[model samples]
Target chain A: MSKEKIRELKKKIEALVIAIPRELEAYEFYLDLAEKSADDAPSKEMFMFLAKQELFHRDHLEKMMNDLQSQLEEELKKGK
Target chain B: MLPLKKLIVHTHHIATHFTNALFPVSAALITLYLITDKPSFETACYYSMIFGLMSIPVAYGSGFYDWRTRFQGRRTFIFDHKVVFGIIFLILASIVVIWRSYDGGIMYSVGLNKWLYVTLVYSLTGIATWLGYLGGKFI
Candidate 1:
């Protein structure tokens, strides 16, 4: 790929890396909400479910970040 | 006339809670599959969808009964909103599951853009969350 294409891919990877923390924050928020709602069975169950979903989102984003990083490394190697 | 005491403690309560709970699981599984491109995650997503679909009828049946008996035929705006969104959520979720199944039970592997499938599942999750929020008003 050309230098321009490589630069764009790097930028996109950087954005994805930055998003990882935000997903973690969401996970924490949902988990905390789930804990607080423990007295209310239905509400607690709902929040717990959301928390699990957020955890999955965080894990998935982490995997995506790793994949993008690998792709970025490949592009950089080609550019070099 | 349905007894007020029974309406307060309907068996459907468990079904509705289980149904609402499964929505998040479905959303999470799909999100995991989208990011990791894992076949296992995709399979889990399919299973979650199937479970969610199974729970819907029980949840809806009980919820409808409660609405009719407890609310006394008065359709409040909030209740109507919940009903409408609930139906929409069901349709959207069904489409996602059916599409994924017909596409060979793999989302990213399908010919269609992966992001589009991810977006569809995300929207379904958002709709389910909204429905839960509306339902919370009753509590």
Candidate 2:
């Protein structure tokens, strides 16, 4: 790829990296709301469940970054 | 990001939540219909389909948004009940839709006994709870 195109992709990737922590924060906030009330069994269960899912998302994102870094490294080595 | 871009992305995210909201709302309505033996059971089925259908795009889009925009380089799966649970419930909702809407209409019987419908609701509601759990973990 050309230098300009590479620059743009790099910019995009950097922006995405910034979003990871923010997304995790948002998920936590939402989870709190979900868990605040427990009028019924279902209500109690669902909110807790949603909170769990958000945590899961955080884990997934971290793993994805690690994998992508390795991939980027491999490509860099090949070019060298 | 520019304000316009952020607004667009936010709208997309909210739409996903709205779509998922359909499943529970419809499930509760279906329960009401079944208990009173109201003819409204058919209406409930229709509503369930609509709600379940909404989840497809919402789940897909919100999920896509997170994957593409937010969680691109993180270890997002270690605590990933959200991915696993969400996918399972979405699949179940789709199956229920097909089961109910077969033969092109509710009136057109697919020859399944009445008990099956009851079973479907129970199963779907149970799955919904599981989904809620996974979703909760995320928060």
lDDT of each: 0.71, 0.59
Work out the TM-score per prediction.
Answer: 0.56, 0.51
Candidate 1's displacement at residue B104, Å, is 1.9
Encode model 1's per-residue lDDT on B1-139: one tens digit a residue.
Answer: 5455465436567776776777678778877776787788878877777788788887787778766664534444566787898888788778877877787644655555566777777787787778777766555
Give candidate 2 misplaced runs (Cα > 4 Å). Answer: A1-20, A23-80, B1-9, B77-79, B103-113, B136-139
Give the local distance difference test score of model 1. Answer: 0.71
Best by DockQ: 2
Worst 10-residue lDDT window, candidate 1 chain A: A13-22
- Tell me, by lDDT, which candidate is best: 1
**Cα error of candidate 1 at position A15, Å:** 46
Residue-by-residue lDDT tens digits, candidate 2, B10-123: 665565455456666666766776577575765766665666677566556655565555444243332255566667767767766776766334433455645566566567
Our tally of clashes for model 1 stands at 0
Interface RMSD, prediction 1 = 20.8
Measured with C-alpha atoms, the lDDT of residue B43 in candidate 2 is: 74
